[model samples]
Target: MSLSRLVQRLRHAALCAAVGLMAAVPAAHAQSDADAGAFPAKPLRFIVPYPPGGPLDLMARALGEKVRASLGQPVIIENRAGAGGNIGADVAAKAAPDGYTLVMGAVATHAINPWLYASLPYDPIKDFAPITLVAAVPNVLVMNKEFAQANGIASVADLIAYGKRHPGRLNYGSGGNGSAGHLAGELLKARAGLDALHVPYQGAAPAQLALLSGQSDFMFDNLAAAAPLIRDGKVQALAVTTLARSSLLADVPTIDESGVPGFDLGTWFGVFATGGTPEPVVQKLNQAYVQALRQPDIVDRLRVMGSQAQPLSAQDFARMVAAEKEKYREIVKLSGASIN
Candidate 1:
């Protein structure tokens, strides 16, 4: 063959090989799209940082039902409560990044624990991928009605003033050290300039019991846990810890406006998957949660529990976590709260 003809044939072969490779690329891309579209083909396990019968557990179960219905797969709730919520959070953070395991993370586990614990098993900000901020539950300052009346505590402002005048004489109960209730009380103490001692319990129910029995002067509890008692006149709600008045407790003023300026703390729950989950999967989970939050039944249940349905995008949730981390770092410093 002529040299020019030989060269032409060789170039044509190379061109044909390149064309074949290019044709296979779309087939691979299509397979990936197919896999991403068929997410949650199996059951999903959602880990709650608290045990059953608590606010976080209740919220998880409620939301999990909707997620199951929406995804057409079973969404199971796994409780791994301990270490001020660090144990369960660490489990979720270290879970497989395949979107099968998620965690219902709370303010304590996600925002405060990092600053409170000297050596966390997982990085709060980096170890897990944030899916969405599912809901927000305002913390209520409740005192046993009879106890409050006996102590002549009628209003939140009065309680703070009295506690200041009689420093170290008053003590408040919390779910546990560095829990949301604990941080809320600490924020109150720091803002009100009061010397009230803290009494941490295993959970809010116990804390409420302590307040009822007059073992503690007052208790900071999730509105869900305190609302029924407050309504039945068992406990007198002095104020809510949110910056704005909660619709569930419109009559109760916010602590920020009640005497302690800039006092804002509330327990929040969100969903997160392990880091390295595919972006498409994260988007799918976020959309599912947003839909679940809008369901009428879920909305009613959350509202009755004194929690509001709030949803945010994955990026927005990440930014929210970062902001909370910064805020709580300052709070942990001011409150001198450390797990180690």
Candidate 2:
């Protein structure tokens, strides 16, 4: 062959090889996308970082049922309770990014606890891929009926004024140091300028029991847990910890309006998979949750529990988590709350 022709043929062969390699890349990527789209081909494990019957656990079960129906797979609930929900969250964070394992992440695990603890086993923001924010539940300020009646505290203003006059004589209970209830109480103290003592319990149930038994003067409780008690007259609803009044307790005023202006704290629950999960799988989960939230029966059920569905895209949810982390960092600084 002529030298020029030989060189041209070699160059053409190299060009063809490069084109073939580039073509194969997309084919592989497309196959991967197809596999991700066919996700949950088997059973899915939904991890709840708390014991059964709690708000997180109950919400997980409810959502799991709907997810199972939508995906045509069994959504199993696995309770791995401990370390203020860090244990199970760590498990989920380190899990395989196959979309089969999911965690029902709460504000404690996703936002608050990360800053509260001196060292966490997993990175709250980077360790997991956010699916969607399923729901938000506000905290209600409640006092034991007997305690309120005895102290003549009929309203939130009355309670605040009384706390100021008594200074430290009043105490409020919460699930634990970094819990939403505890943070709500601290926010109230800072905004309302009241000097009430903080009493921490192992969980919300014990905290509510302490309030009911008059062991604590007041408590900031999840509306789901405290609403029924307030309706039963076992506790007095002072106010809710949100910017606006809750529809479930329309008669009750918000802490911002009641006395503490600009005071708002609430808890949210969402689903998350391990980091590096495919975008298509995350989109699928978000779509399923958004659809579930739109169901009339699901809406009514969540409303009765003093919660409302809130669905967000993966990017939006990630931004929400970052904002929450910064917000709580300021809160922790102001409140001087540290787990270590």
Where does model 1 exceed 4 Å of error? Answer: 1-35
CA lDDT, every prediction? 0.81, 0.82
* Model 1 weakest lDDT span, ten residues long: 1-10
How many residue pairs collide in each prediction?
A: 0, 0
lDDT of 2 by residue, 176-210 (tens): 88778888888788887888999999888899999
Error of 1 at 25 (Å): 24
TM-scores, all candidates, are: 0.86, 0.86
Q: Against the true structure, whose lDDT is highest?
A: 2
lDDT of 1 at 1: 28
